[model samples]
Structure formats: C-alpha cells, structure tokens
Target: MFCFHRLGLRAAAALIVGLGIATSARAEFPDRPIQFVSPYAAGGANDFLTRLMAQHMGDELKTTIVVDNRAGANGVVGASFVAKAQPDGYTVLMGNSATHGTNPTLYPDVTYDPVKDFAPIGMVGSVPIVLAVNAKLNVRTVAELIAYGKANPSKLSYGSSGIGGTGHLAGEAFNAAAGLDMVHVPYKGDAPAAADAMGGQVSMAFVGVASAASMLQSGKIRILAVASPKRSSSLPDVPTLEEAGFKGLYFAQWYALFTRAGTPAATIEKLNGALKLALARSDVKKAMASQGADAAYTTPAALNTFYRSEVKRFGEIIHRLNIKATN
Candidate 1:
C-alpha cells in the first residue's frame, strides 16, 4: 500500500507538471512578431482601420504586428492566405462585411469559408454608409430621391466602390424597397466613386461617412439618408434610413478580426482580451471617430453569432436583388 501510494503521488506530480508546461506555453504565445493580413490594397478605409487597430493591439500584446497587404478579388486573396496558414495565434485576418459577409455569397468560387475556417476574435468598429447625391440633382430628401428615380427610371445612376459591397447592396435595397430603377455604376474605390458623383458622372452613390465627409462639407453632394438604424454622431443632422420613412432599410460596414479556426481556445481568449483592452483605449476611440468609425467591441462568442447572422442577411439581400460582383 505504501509503494502504491508513492507511485500515485509521482504520477500526479507528473500530470501537474505537464499541465503547468502547457499553460506556460500558452502564456508565452506571440513571443514572435504576428502577421496581420489585410486582403485589400493599401490606403483604403479597410487598410487604414486595420493598421490603426494593429498598432494598438500590438501595444497591448507587447509584440510587433506586421501588416501584410495581399490585395485582390475584393479581399479574397488575403482571406484565403490567412485561412490556409497554420492555425497558430500569429496569423490573423482583418476582415470586414465584404470579406466575411458578402464576398462568400457574391462569389460562387470563394475559397475560404468565413465561419468554418476562421475563429472570430472581435469587432473593431463599424462605418455607417451614407446615401448622397450630387448637389446638382434636384432631390432634397430620401422620398424625393425615390420619386425622382421612379419617374426617371434608368435616367438615375448611382456609383459604388465595387459591386457586391455594402454600398452596392444598399443601393439595390433602395431600388427594391422604393420601387426605383436607378442604375448601378461600379468604381475602383470610394474616392473615385464620390468624385464621379460630384462631377455628375453619376447621380449619387452610397459611400462611407469617412470617405464622403469632404464632399458633404464642400456641398458637392447632398446626403439624403444614412444607412444605419440610428443617426451617426459624425453626421448629427442626418437621419437614418428608418427615420427617413424606409423602416427596415439598414446597412453598415463592420470590421472585425479573426484567426485560423483551429487556433487554441486559450490563445483566442488571450487575443480577445487584448482586443477588448485595445478598443477601450481613448486614443483608439478618437482615431476611429475621426474616420467616422465607432469603436464597437464584442466578445468572441458575440462576434461569431453576429458574423453568422450578417452572412445570412447579406446573402439574402444578394439573392433578393440578384446583385452580382462586377469585378
């Protein structure tokens, strides 16, 4: 009995030591530089926001984060790269509504499964899209714009950063809900899209508040409605689509972070904790506000649920409107 008791004690000690080593390994995670992938080109809103988040998140993690831009196919290139990378905590994706929510539904050949291949970390923020027309247009309100589009049919044209983007879907939703026949004009990015709208190359475009702020201030465009459920703090005077009499017409581009799906749960917890801390920083919030982005954070579980629902909602809109990706 004495020998047996000693043997049991030794085995228990070994097990405890093993567990301690495992815990230590997790605690020491991210000892090296982390690779943050943004699947879009540099200088766009997505890239800018991703870089900003990475800076603060890196500071919290006490490690360097290198942003790798792999632009192509509307975020598919970077997303696929991260999806196939080792399921370690070092490789992550800065994905948005397009990469995770709409691109999968819009592209029949999408390589990565947004939910199946990635473990959501948390949401960074959301930019409310605004519907604005060239000041040259005679319409003054959302109702008037709809009436004009209905009366003019193809005579009304709207530009978007790209097809199957939040802006594109918002335009299509408007067309269906208000019984309008506005044509969609796709541009390389929001800058060109807004520029064309101001130049009268298109009647209007659904653009993010940050990208459209200059034109809104310069009186080059007249914002008819914001695509958020409520008025944005950035545009205090602007009303939501619901407030504009189009209840249930809502759209916003949300940005979130993710890692390969098989990353250890403990690592995810650590990353999520760091993310919450970074988002809570006042400077981060101010920087986001400057870009018309609200610093909205969510737990990993909450983000997963929200991501799934957004995928479904965006997919339904794509099908309902028969929207297609032009590029």
Candidate 2:
C-alpha cells in the first residue's frame, strides 16, 4: 500500500508538470514564423493589402509573417486551405467581403461556414465600390442617368466583374431603388468590364475603388456616386449614393483577418492587438489611401458581430437575386 501511494503521488506530480508545459506552450503563441494566406491572385487589392498588413503585423509581433497566395475558385481555394489548417495562431487568412460575407450564399458547395469555421481577428478596412460611367456617356449625375434609363428601358446597361458578384448586386439594387430598367452586362473580370464601360460598350459599372483607381485617374471613366455610406477620401469630390438623393444603397467591401475556429481566446486577442497596432501606423494608412481604401479596424467581438450581419445582408441579396456561383 505504501509503494502504491508513492507511485500515485508521483503520477499526480507528473500530470501537473504536463499541464504546466501545455499552458506554457499555449502562451508562447507565435514563437515561429506565421503563414499569412491571401486567398486571391497576386497584384490584386486583397494580396496587396495582405502583404502590407503582414509586414506591419510582423513588425509588431517581432516575428516573420510570410504571405502565401492561393488564388483560384474565386477565393474558395485559399479559404478552404485556411479552414482546414491547424487552430494554432500560425496560419491565418486575409478574409474579405466575398469570402466571409457572400460566398456562402453564392456558392452552393462552399466548404466552410463563415461564422463557425474560423475565428475573426479584426477588420482591416473597407474598400468602397464606385459607380462609374464612360467619359462621354452624356450623363453627368445619378439623376440624369436615372432619367435617361427611365426614358429608354434596357438602354442603360451596366457591367460587372462577373455574374453574381458584388458589382452585379449593386447594379441590381441601384436599378430597383432608382425605379429604372437597366440591363446587366457581365464580363469575365473587372478589367474587361471597366474597359468596356470606359469605351462606352456598357452604360456604367460598379467597380471596386482599388480596381478603378487608374480609370479614375486617367479620365477613362466618370464616377457618378460611391456606393458606400461615406465618400472615400481617395475621391473626396465624389458624392455617396445617399448624398446623390438615393438612400439605402449602402454596400461596403469588408476586409479582415481570421484564423481557424478553436484558436485560443488569448491568441485571438494577441493577434487582434497586433493588427490594431499595424493599422494605426502612418505608413499603413498611407498605403490604404493610395489604394483608394480606408484604414479601419474593429475588435474581435465587433468583427464577429459585423461579419454575421454582412453575411445575412448579402445572403438576402443573393437569394432575392437568385445569384449562383459557377464554381
């Protein structure tokens, strides 16, 4: 009995030691380089912002953060990769409006749940979508465009990045709100859509600020109104759709950081803190401005709540429009 008691005591001590080691390991959180996955092609807004944020976050965390581009299937490829990654803080995804907000409704075979499959770190910022027309479309303001469309049914056609994209939804929403009958012209991508719009192939288009920067600068297209609630600093002269006498057309492009579900709360807080620090830097703000994006950040809880609302909002739009993803 004495020997058994001694052995039991030893086992308890070993168990305590093991628990201590596990706690320490959890506390060590980002002891090694982190892999930041950008679920889009290189040179796009998502990739650009991810690289910049990774650099700044790496600086704050005092560790290396490598950006891995996993572009395909309209962001599902990279999103799935991150969804299946370990719950450790080492692997994270740069989630945007499509991945966490609308993909579930758009794609019938989405592999992960936006709210359940990952832990939201925090929001990076919002990229505003612009409603632009060809330079020589002969329409100056939203009112004029509406009047023209009303007079000529199906004469006013708008282009989008692709079918069922945010741009398409925005155009449809705009048509419904303005009481106009405008046709939607889907292109393969933003470049071609905006290009055709600039060349007068289409009457107008809903374009991301980042993708429309050059077009705005080169006088290729004339912006009618911004789709966001507030006007973008990049185009201070441009008015929001509300300011242009059309309300409830507030569509935002949300970008944020996220990790797989089951990540430790402490680790999520640490990453959120690092992201806040990086977003507050002057250089980071400048980069965002150059890309026609705003520097915005939110707490983890706030992000989770906002993400859910976005998913619901966009999901409704997708359902009502009957938009389906091809891939």
Candidate 3:
C-alpha cells in the first residue's frame, strides 16, 4: 500500500512539473516587445505593410511591435542582419521576393541562404506587376505594345526597378513569351524607374501596381497589362498578361515573415498565430487591397513550397535568357 501511495505521489509531481514547463515555455515565448524589420525604403509598399502589420501584430500579441527600416543593398544588409540574429522570436524580417527568392540567383555572395538561414513564419502578401507605358505614347493595350516593340525592335526601351527585380523578370518574361526585342534599362528602384517611364525617358516598364497606381490614375502612364495571375481589383479594367496573350509571364513582389533559423517551434508558431490573426483584420485587408496587395497569410510549410517553386521558376527563366548581373 505504501509503494502504491508513493507511486501516485511521483506521478502527480511529474504532472505538476510538466505543467510548469509548458507554462514557462509559453511565458518566455515573448517576454518583451517584438521588432519587425523592413528592408525597404520608407513609404514603399513593403515598408507600409511592415508598419501596419507591426501595429496589428502588437494588438494580437498584446505587446509593442515596431518597424525598423533598414533599406539598402537590395534588402541584403537587413536580411543578413536578421539571418545572423539570435533565433529568439524577437527580431523578425519582413522580407520580400528580392531578398528571399531572387537574390540567391542574382548575387553570388549574398551572405545568407534564403532557405536555410531563416525559419518561415508566414507569407504576408504580393504586389502584382503591371506593364505600364507613357500615356502619350499611344500604347494602351498589350497588343499595341507588342506590335510596337516588334516593329521598333531595340528602339523600345523597358525599365525595371533594378537588376533581377520582379519587374526585371517580368520584362524578360514579356520578351521571352512575346518574342519582342526591347532594350532593358535597370533603375535604382521602382519609384525612379516608374518616374522615367512616366516622363517618357523609356517607352515602357514593368511597374509594381502600387508604384504605378498614382501615375495610372493621373494619366501619366497607361497600363498595358497586369502580370499577376488574376486582374487586380483596384484595376479591374486591365487584363492579365496571359489574357493579353503573354502566357507564363506572371510576376509579383511576394512578401513573407521569417525569423532566424533554430527558433523554438512553439515560438515560431506563436508569431505565426499573431500574424495570421492580424492579417485577417478588415482594415489590414483593405490597406493591402488598396495597394493591390493580396492578403495571403501562408503557413510555414506552404511558404517553403512556394519559395522553392519560385526559385526554380525564376532560375529556369534566368538560365534560358542568360540573365547575369553585368556590374
């Protein structure tokens, strides 16, 4: 009888200890506020999303969350910083396609592995790319742009945000799919490239929907076609590239949340839960939609699959087009 009593006591103690461990893990998961890093310029689409997401995430997590813009080096410096950070679920990188999928193939020594260095939390959103041309150029439709490019050959120059940007890849996809010979011009960023395109410095450019929304509305630039899988609700009148006969040329600025690798699974899941809830808010949905951004909060496993597929997708395109950074 004493042995059984002792066994019962030991079991109860083990149960109590397990409960304490679980409670401690949950408590330490986020002992303090969190920081979300935006590796893009302030006022940019990605930066705006980061700030808004931070606010909403803070509300969800019941902790202060802030955005720190570390905009430079095509998101490499900031991404590298996050990659080397402690996997403590405190510092998260609001990374985009540039730093995650496209840079690995574009920059040989980018200082971090896109797949291995970080643990995926969730995919935030993606900004669709649109083919916009100077309003006065008299090119309003995709057919007209294709015709003009074919007839003028190297005379029609297309600008991109930068080398290896989604806009750049969109332009290359256009040329590949339509067999057009347009001169490719690389710009410093989306705003500058769209500026030149609006000013008629270039005949056309693959512009991010957010970057070109104002110009398109003001008649500064005419959108030829959208490169997204579906027509943007903000620009429902515009047709998709595939609908315009340029199939297999989809491109967009995909954004996702990630933390340094080796973060505890519970910690990662906690962050993901907060983000998921935050992104589902109506205001968050509306803000993202206004910028032509999709409110897609993908699971870590789903994000990993999508990231790998995009890497492969762009890799094939790069290899086929001989796209090398000629610095």
Candidate 4:
C-alpha cells in the first residue's frame, strides 16, 4: 500500500509538469515571421509608415515583420486579400483611410466588409491633405489658383491618389466650394499623383503631406493650401483651406493596423500592446513627424469606434458630392 501511494504522488507531479509545458507552448505566439501587407504602392505614405512601424513593432514582438505592397483598386485588392487570409496573427494589414474609410461606399463590388472582415489592432497616424500645383503654373496662393482654374477651366485638372481616396474627395470638395470644373485624375498612389503634378501632367495634385514633402524642396510643386481645419506641422507656413476662404474643407489621411477577423482576443491584445510600444518610441514618433504624419495610438476598441465613424462620415460626404469611382 505504501509503494502504491508513492507512485500515485509521483504520477500527479508528472502530470502537473506536463500541463505546465503545454501552457508554455500555447503562450508562444508569433514564433515565425509575420507578413505585414501595405495596400498601396511603395514610396507612398502608407508604405513608408508601414515599413517604419514594422521595424519597431517587429523588435517589440521579437519576430520579423515583412512589408508587402499589394497596390490596386485604391486598396481594394490588398484589403480583400487580408480579409480572406487565415485568422492568424501572422498575417496583418496596414489599412488606411482609403481602404477602411471610403472604399466601401465608393466601390460597389468591394469584396471585404471593413468592420466585419478584419479586427482592428490600433490607430497609426494621420496626415493632412494639401493642394499642390506645379511650379510652372506660377500659382502661389489659393486665391490665385482659384482664379487660374476659373480662367482656364479646360487646362485645369486635379490628380489624386485614387478615385475614392481622401485626396479625391478633397479635390471634389474644392471643386464644389470654388465653383470650378477642373477634371479629376486618379493615380495608383499619392507619389505618382504628386509626381505627375510636378511634371505638369496635371495642374494640381491633392495628396497627403508626406507624399508632397520631398517634392516641395525640389521647387517642382507649390503647395497652395492645406485641406485641413488647421495648418499641418510639416507645412506650418501653409494656410488651411478654411483660412484661405473655403470654409468647411477638411481632409486627412489616417492609417491603422489590422489582422483578420476572428483572431483570438488574446492575440489581438498582444499585437496591440506591441504596436503601442512601437508608436511610443521617440525615434518612431520623430520619424513620423518629419514625414508629416503624427504617430497616434489607440486601444483596439477605440480604433474600431473611430473607424466606423469615419466610414459613416465618408459615406455622407461621398453621397453629397456625388463622388463615383473611376476605376
């Protein structure tokens, strides 16, 4: 009887040890590299910020985070891909205003539902949109550009990152407020739109400040007014569209991180924590600021609420403006 009792105690101890080992294994998430999808072309604000966050977030999570560009249909292609990906934390997406905010209403056949198909990780940052004209046009201020556009309506045209992007809506708002008929041109991303504006392919380009930052120094494009309620820190000297006599004109491009929906709540929390840590870093914040983006972070719930509100807001704006996707 004594021998049998000792064996039972030993078996119990071994069972406890085995259970502990199983728990430890389960806790080990992201043992491999994570794929970070950026739903825009490289060199744009989204791509730039994604790579920046990936580097720091990967360090925090102790895993490799690869940034993949899947550019098409104003973020539809990449967003849809993420929506259909396995609900593991390994596959993530750097979603932005165009992908989560305006695309639903703009694209009639978009495959993914922004709110239902993905879980929100956290907010990244936002950059104000600016109206920049080619330097060759000799337009310096909002008033001068408005006059030039009015005088030569046929020659005046505005380019945007894409048909449903915030830049596109900003251009439409400008057209309505100024009573001008400038043609709307769409490009794959903000970088291309800004580049074409500099090359005189378009009279002006409505783009995020980050896309226009480097080009501003080349004397190729002259920013007339920011399409935001206040001046952007990146272009502190530039006037807001409201201050430039166009009241109620405000547009900003925001970014965030998301994983496929139905991911374990614990995993989402873990990823969110890493993202918060990354954004809190001084170097990351400084880099984002230098590129005209503010490194903003929020809880998963807060980001979801904000994203839903933005979708509703953009829907109303698109409806009122009668904006239609050209692509």
lDDT of each: 0.89, 0.86, 0.87, 0.90
> What clash count goes with each model?
0, 0, 0, 0
**Model 4 ranges with Cα > 4 A deviation:** 6-10, 28-32, 86-88
Give the top-scoring candidate (TM-score).
1
RMSD for all candidates, in order, please: 4.0, 3.6, 4.1, 2.6
**Residue-wise lDDT of candidate 4 within 212-311, one digit each (tens)?**
8779888999998898887888888999999999988879999999999999898899899999999999999898987789888999999999999989
Residue-level lDDT of model 3, residues 60-107, one tens digit each, is: 888898788888779998899899999998999999888887888888
Model 4, C-alpha of 9: deviation from truth (Å):
4.8
Candidates ranked, most accurate by lDDT first: 4, 1, 3, 2
Pairs that clash in candidate 3:
none
Per-residue lDDT of candidate 1, residues 83-168 (tens digit): 99999889999999999999989998999999999999999999988998999888899988888777776899999888998999
Better of 1 and 4 by lDDT: 4
- Please write out the lDDT profile of model 2 over residues 1-327, one tens digit for every residue: 999999999999999999999998766778899999999989877888999999999998999999999988778889999999999888999998889988888887888888889999999988788898988868889998888888888788899887666788888888888988888888866777888888889988887776666676778789888998888888889899999888878776668999999999988998999999999999899988877779889999999999899889999988886666652
Q: At residue 107, give the lDDT of candidate 2.
A: 85
Q: How many angstroms is residue 71 displaced in model 4 relative to the true structure, after the best TM-score fit? A: 3.8
Candidate 2 root-mean-square deviation in Å? 3.6
